[model samples]
Target: MNKYIVKMLSVNDNNAFFQLINTNRERLEDFFAGTVLRTKTIADTINYCEEIEQKINKKSYFPYLILEKESNVIVGFIDVKNIDWNIPKAELGAFIDSKHEGKGIITTTMASLIDDIVNEHHFKKLLCRISSRNTRSIRVALNSGFELEGTIRCDYKTTKGEIVDLNYYGKIF
Candidate 1:
């Protein structure tokens, strides 16, 4: 019944964007332990913001910053990636502040992002890949109307020199 999501439309709040990514990087590092996903330094984070800015400029990606209402802090974010106009499919990615894990913040944020993107964008399908070991992410995808497609065996290099399989999920717009 309350608004739990807001897109990063105005560029006036540069601090907000940096703050969100800086505070959650550690949690992201852990969540994506098997992959090189986190921004280890401020420069990297800045570069990321710049990259996101470029993506937005090109209309190739749309990102949203998720703010937890009571706390007024960005506890998580959901992004639509790999947007392909021809295929009408976009890859999905999400992250939540570790402190807020197990809560439904990501779900709420996801619902909001999906609704807006579906209404504004013409993409016909959404695609998501979840590390096989990350059950929480898989659950979120399944609960959010995503259907499990198949498992890709030994598809990626994870941390500690381990290979991980990824489960694919898809949904129609």
Candidate 2:
């Protein structure tokens, strides 16, 4: 049996989804400011989930909830955003529950999703923009078959109001 199941984010996932973001707000605030800041309440999560569904239907963003099969809880999330249909590429983003970190769950799940992103989604390339200081995520990108493309200086300001460089990693399918 699969250890994890990846389901598209839906409105019904509001509660568990909010809990996941709330539980890791501190850890995610630095790099994942958009989600951490936007989803501060269950109501906020409901709105965000609705927005995600709209984006999915518009073919602009695809977000998946990673469910741990045994516990049936949301253990992580993966997203394909910034899609450029012309280039047929998208940027990938992901975060795992703090409790489930370093268990190879994100790595394995990402590897599998890479296949789907290419074969099923018909994406020509996938990209991951990771903070220069986040070695864990850089390793995840490398281990999942992405190569360092370049670095963007002062990519964006974090929720803490600190600017950080982002390392661009990409895999061409």
Candidate 3:
């Protein structure tokens, strides 16, 4: 496997991260629907990054930027959101640049972070809510050991405003 690194999203990563998102905007929108970002300019990306950074500081969300270790280029991201301290569970969302999609980067990165997410963050359950039509993402979640839980009907709206069902997958630590 190629070496990769996962770091908490930071102010310093704005440019690289923005470029990655902008380049993959269309592909990302296909799967992410409601969550896919549509950043038209650098300022928009900076604002988005700053919001995520604040959430990280407040412990309400954790968003990590994935990079190629050799070049330190932004390749993807995995985020843990909807953190519930009482239930000790969080939702996991991830995506990789289309160019890097088939290399197993996301699966490996998620596996690598499981330990830290469970031990350091104290999350008992990690959930992945994937669009039912997104086979690639479902495969990634399964490869990382997340089990199919159930389907959420009309869970989200697509970029084009179509309602879709979501496949829920979870990993219990």
lDDT of 2 by residue, 34-151 (tens): 8887799999999999988898889898998899988899999999999999989999999999999999888989988888779988898999999999999999999999999999
The candidate maximizing TM-score is 2
- Give a tens-digit lDDT track for model 3, residues 28-47: 77565433463567887778
Q: Per the 3 Å backbone cut-off, how many clashing residue pairs does candidate 1 have?
A: 1
Native-referenced Cα lDDT, model 2 = 0.91
Q: Candidate 1's error at 39, in angstroms?
A: 3.4
lDDT of 1 at 30: 40
Model 3 stretches with alpha carbons more than 4 Å out: 30-38
Q: Specify the poorest-scoring 10-residue window by lDDT in model 3.
A: 30-39
TM-score for all predictions?
0.83, 0.96, 0.93
The C-alpha lDDT values of all candidates are 0.73, 0.91, 0.86
**Whole-model lDDT, model 3:** 0.86
Worst 10 residues of 2 by lDDT: 29-38
For lDDT, the strongest prediction is: 2
**Runs of candidate 2 exceeding 4 Å displacement:** none
TM-score rank, highest first? 2, 3, 1
